[model samples]
Target: MEKKLKKLKTDNARKQIKKNQNIFNIWTKLLRISAIWIRFFQWRKWHKDHTYPKPQVGPLMVAEIQQAKERWITITQRQAFPEEINSLRNNQQVVRGPLRTLSPYLDNDLLRVGGRLENSNISANRKHPVILPRQHVVTEMIYREYHQRYMHVGPQGLLAAIREEFWVLRGRDVARATVHNCLKCFRARPSSLQPAMGQLPSARVTPSRAFAQTGVDFAGPLVVKLGLRKSTTTKAYVAVFVCLATKAIHLEAVSALSTAAFMAALKRFMSRRGKPSHIWSDNGTNFVGARKELECCFKKQLTGRTVPEELVEEGVQWVFTPPSAPHFGGIWEAAVKSFKHHFVRVAGAAILNFEELSTLLAQIEACLNSRPMTALSSDPADLQALTPGHFLIGTPVLMPPEADYSEMPDNRLKRWELVQKITQMFWKRWRLEYLSSLQSKAKWLNPTANVKIGTLAVLKEDNVPPLQWKMVRIIEIHPGKDGIVRVVTVRTASGQQLKRPTVKICPLPMGKEE
Candidate 1:
């Protein structure tokens, strides 16, 4: 009997909830049904709201959709749209047309209007005001205003323009393009040219002789390790070397990159694989800052080209890449990639400081030299992997280098025709074949072509026609549509008003950029 009474109370509570739901509002009308009935009868309410009076269904349909468009600051679109709406109504224009939705206020109005019309059973997708998207019109308006006011753009100029002038902020080129296309700028964009077939990049420099030349690249200033026993933050760096002919690599890690570590790396390089004839490193602090600064005294000047002097003493020629041309330092850069891929997989993070770091370099170098590589040798058809040591094994020490303090003996060099002997000794055999077949036809070492106004260009200061050069300032900046740029002096000390001369820029036509 008690269980029956408790069940009765629970049923009463459920019935109370059902009765309360009848008062809930749905759409324009109040619902008056039990919760269970509401669920069961929802389809009837929807049909009553959505379906037109049965007789009205046979008439041809007429409806409008509204979308938002940008408006001028001077006009309130609320006024403009209503006036347009009244005109449409009075004219009895049967054609459904787009409504211009402007501003968020306008767009919100249009959205609400669309929602209302949708609620009233009209199609929301067709013939709406404000067809131009908020993002699109704003972007167009801002850019159009800017291009009219400021004709040219710089890196800083562009940044400032985007912030204050262009409507879309920061690196939003896609929106800019959209706006650009919709506005006056649509007529200004140049036609794109047909893409030419890409030529194969030349194989990395193949020196005339083996072990005669080597290239260098920096790999890391890896995250400092505190200690194997106690972690403390201290730094270390890695340097890499690659042979020109065989493509084998050498890697070394140094503690603090002082003159001391630099020298130690050189010594280790020489100890393992004999000395190279030529060395190529970028203008890095480690390679350039090894010497003390020169102080002018009474009569004479101190001369120390630090790393270059060291290379000269070691009988190794030194060549540096033209500034801004990392492509020329291809070998070591490739080796650097391999090092990163290998180091991450193998290096232990617990080790820190120079001592431990330098100790690990040998193991890293071994891994780099041992990896199988598929880059074609001088011969396009041949492929091989000769690890650093493998290339040296059983090779005749033809001259049995004396490792003397002074230069080679005159007789031995004379007998061997040193230059020819070195060339034949080290060049990949396939290269000799290629050279034998190569033409001596004329070509420019630094190719260039005819210059035009607004032709994108990079200036060359030190890279003139001579064998060696320097680049200090941008000698030419292409000015679009503003034809000839004539210049007399780059140094403002000389004068600023002088005409600027323009030079042909990069991606020079095959034979032209020389």
Candidate 2:
């Protein structure tokens, strides 16, 4: 009987491994396809612009003529784009970068648009059709995602690199901005730009690397009174560092809310977990603006853009998001939410002190990390039951659950050296294989166009049936170069389509009044 049970368990384990491998295969294929498209887009940036090179300057001022015969520039080649780019071509800005990633729908469309080196990630995302904003993330995160996708340039250089890459893919006029904004280009100043160096991170680099990309944040100044004396009160702070890939966390409670206190907590983590690559947080005055502005009239004139900073030099990079926006740092936000539940409800409505709370945090983290997660939905037994630690670090640690940790590769390398090497190596290999898979899956080329200008389109959805309406004017059309659109709609009354990036257009309605 015992042998039978053991055999069943072994069989289940083997089955689980196979299931994980299948998911990995599909995900990697997506990455490979995306990578090739990016490589092609990088090639054609140097091609020249069509139509009399420079804009024709005369009394005629015929925009229609310019729009009709204009040519599209290869974003990578730094050439010219087609004039039919958009109706607002005259006012459009021609910031250049490579177009990376092709649309899945169209066989030949580039997914990302590009601009000049001077343009920031925010600028490029706004200009291109492919790099749209995600639902839960802030705009900065959107930029971060774009840089990760291309792996060609940093946030600042995305605009330029995108254009260069794009030209290689199609060598066509991208959107309307280049032609409209060319005249305005003279106002721009010149400066040297740094290109992106490291390979992109592999589909999240899960594994012990889970604890590598951590986000640390302080949850509160919990005013809890404890100890034998009734007057004795404790001021405490929760310092949490969560692995990005694994979602496993190392949490603690400290006595005070000072920079000094935070440093002590960090040191504790390093002693055990080792140094992390990135530490995300909210720009608290303690962790951020320690230095006062140097009030020198002469020195102040030297540079206008400066933010106050109080850096922690523990051989780790500290990334801070905007104040009051906790969601910007994903791990920390989740940690706090989980901690609050325990602190307020589970651990008794009673308040906790620095020491007691810290003890509680350790317990909570263990439970959260050990439990398998449902997200790795690919596994049948625990595919859904995989734990957060498994998610971040990757399954089947060097030392499985039964054994202690046998090796620590990070310890041999200096913190920063480890960071750079790991980021470069993992990102390089992952980008190649995984990106190809992304390309195969995200079919953007033959997008289904829903509505057109002058056509009366109906609002369609399941729950909001009555919310639907009749004919309305089609004011605008959001069309990618491939012709298919993401959304189509009318103005007023029973209308649908909440804030999506691309939309179709149709003809205006004839009557409005009853």
Candidate 3:
């Protein structure tokens, strides 16, 4: 009985295996048939839609073109010129529509202009072009097609080309808009936004201690001899510090462009001109690194209670302008220019030693500080005009000593009181003269619309062609105290974010949906 059972089990297992194999074969065959059908259908679709090498214009093709144009014109006219169409159908004049001046009439169910040029010896299409409403999609399509056919010509040329076939309403305005919206034209002639000049910062307009609020910048890699030998030479740089309130400048010579060198220069400046409450500079790598180091030092001193009370009270506050924006630090930039002007004229290709360079810079600083800040008076008896030197010392750095007033009995003659009175007088003149002069904007006199987030723009790069400039999308804006946006943060196509002034961003024309 056991042997008979074993034989039956083996037969049943073999039958089950055979049944599973048959099911697998059936599925594989079905998959192959489906794939073959898919390829066959794709080929059929390609064959049906493919264009012939030399396609003949048959009656069917002509009929299809006529039908499409009629459909498009019917939809467009009904949406835009329904009243005019009704007036024309009733044999009345179009008195109130935009087409009233054009004297439009229907011919073969299509609108055409009834202009005085009807008798001109030209083609029918040119003599009385088909009238199109400007706001409709059909009009846009026709304008775009003609604009492209003319190889992206100017507005006047584009308008003339379109008038050869269609007389679009407000054709000039439409043509201008179409040209403005072209990506290629915009990329070739990208114009940056010109927001109105911003209000002067408090540091610039208000009177303060000389060098209290400072703007710092680096000048150059001036060639300098290492020693008396002319062959042994090394590169050096000038650190220019300008007082925002007084326009006084301090120059320091540094050996290299590094954070350590900058720190040393800063120490020298503070030791001589006093520690500044705020320091403004461009986004140079050395400046950024020094700021970080200073922050770390300040934190440690505060935590350990090692900093003196006076030092803590006079803490340094560093502010950085947006990257690649030199205009933001115009004060120091101007000073650097003045310094170079003097240095170039005086030094004149002469490679001096480091000490000689330092001395020359000091003399130039004195000359700059002694310059008249306000216009000179015509009256010869009037006291010398206020200068940056007045805020630094008691008088101009280059002026001769005045007659001693120690013997005078006036209360202002007292040493401390006289000094205070002199300082007050200087500030009064600054407020009335220098500050007022800054009220008038040098350029960018008109206000424009602010750029919005998600708008596409091109970044203006120095020494780069407009076509090669990177494309960016505005993501954020930085408005001033008066609520004018001058700075914005943008993201590039490579996912890099940059903070740039609006003057460096050229926004592109937006579509209706955008």
Candidate 4:
């Protein structure tokens, strides 16, 4: 029985390998065809706009054209393209000009259009009709002949190169179609512009206290000396908390990424910045593990851990963005980048102890958080850049202070009302200056149609040939709230499914639906 099972497994493995080989062969064939088309297009383009050495049409080329014309005429008499011939005849009658006259001509018992024959009177002139067959084979042959001479120009240029000696009926359209389907051309094409920006989340649009709705992310594995020894090296991580509403940032230094270290960092953040109503973080293992432990504490699973009970009851929610989707947490991610940029320069070539590193991190955090929230005014009289500090402390960090209201009479307003007035003023400026800045899109200007389910696509791989490109069919579309498909689920020939962003997928050209 065991022997039979082993034989069955071997058979399945062989079948799988054969299937993969077959798929590879199909892709190879497609790419080969695409290469031919690309070369033809390249030759055509250069021959049109650029000037090059005129190619001499030998007797062999002339004889080949003559043979192709004869073949086409034979086919035409046999009624292979009776409709096309009849249409041409009708067109010749309706037109009255040199072009109309040129549409009908006889050469060596075969009907030809365009190009005058060379004679002794015009020995310098090389213009002549090089008749071509109706089949794709003859057209490609003509393209290759001129392509080698013109050094692979595109469609328009190639047509110009051939026009000096030959004219094929509807050659322009045929050349264009071939160029459009070229794999080489497609690979070299620029990336398509992205769709319009999606709407801002409520956290960004709403006005709230600093750190009320926050995004948390970690940065760094900076080297810090342990104890007093210069050789004892330890890694330290920084937990960065960014306020979604006010863009205020808070930094915490942790020794490790364990649950205990994160919890300690979170406690310090809550103590100084106040408890966050909602915490948004990426799907990191540490973050996820922390959430699970917090849940256990919230559910009273651990004995004597009752301090977080009230905080849980009051709705301290932790939300995680999708796995592998870092763009979802771009706000905090940007903060992390700014932090790393400055920290790297400040701590250059020095390995500081934990206490020293902690102080430097705090200083860097303050510098980043004080950066302008909106564009600076150019006028000298209008001082003070609008920054996150304005929302947190009611003024810019380095700018001169305004008139103090702290010493005002007690009868003027209650303590809560005074705070409310200041907050309201900050919000008013935030709406006027910050909100307006969000209107312009910095990238991805053009909108494209959404990729539909069941559409065939090729996965683009860098430094890899098109024949090796993984082929798949769209199984599902994951559209954003803006009704644009950004991500999709695809199924391969091996029956495996994968989730990929639209940028990585290259849809195959197909006919329009009827």
Which predicted model would earn the best lDDT?
3
How does residue 150 of candidate 1 score in lDDT?
A: 61
Score candidate 3 by TM-score against the native: 0.80
- Report the C-alpha lDDT of model 2 over 250-329, residue by residue, as the tens digit: 88777788767777787788777876766667777767631112123224544543433322223356665544444345
Residue 123 displacement (Å), model 1: 22
Ranking by TM-score: 3, 4, 1, 2
In terms of lDDT, which candidate is stronger, 3 or 4?
3
Model 3 — which ten-residue stretch has the worst lDDT?
21-30
Q: Provide the lDDT at 265 for model 2.
A: 82
Residue-by-residue lDDT tens digits, candidate 3, 137-163: 557657667777789899999999989
* Candidate 1 lDDT: 0.44
Give candidate 2's whole-model lDDT: 0.45
**Candidate 2 deviant stretches above 4 angstroms:** 1-208, 226-231, 289-314, 376-384, 391-514
Candidate 1 at residue 300, lDDT? Answer: 27
Q: Pick by TM-score: which candidate is best?
A: 3
Better of 1 and 4 by lDDT: 4
TM-score of each: 0.40, 0.34, 0.80, 0.67
- Evaluate model 2: give its TM-score: 0.34
lDDT of 1 by residue, 1-514 (tens): 9799867864674455435433432211111223233333334545766563332233222220001111121122333245544544464332333332211122333321221333444333332223222233333444444444566333344435544411222335533453434312322222211221222113233443335567777777786666666667766778787877566677777666766677677668767767876678766666654322111211122244444544444555567654444544666787888888867776655555556566666666666555533333687666343334335442322224445634645676675596556435445543553333333422323323334333322233334542122212333433323232222123233333223333211211211111
Better of 3 and 4 by TM-score: 3
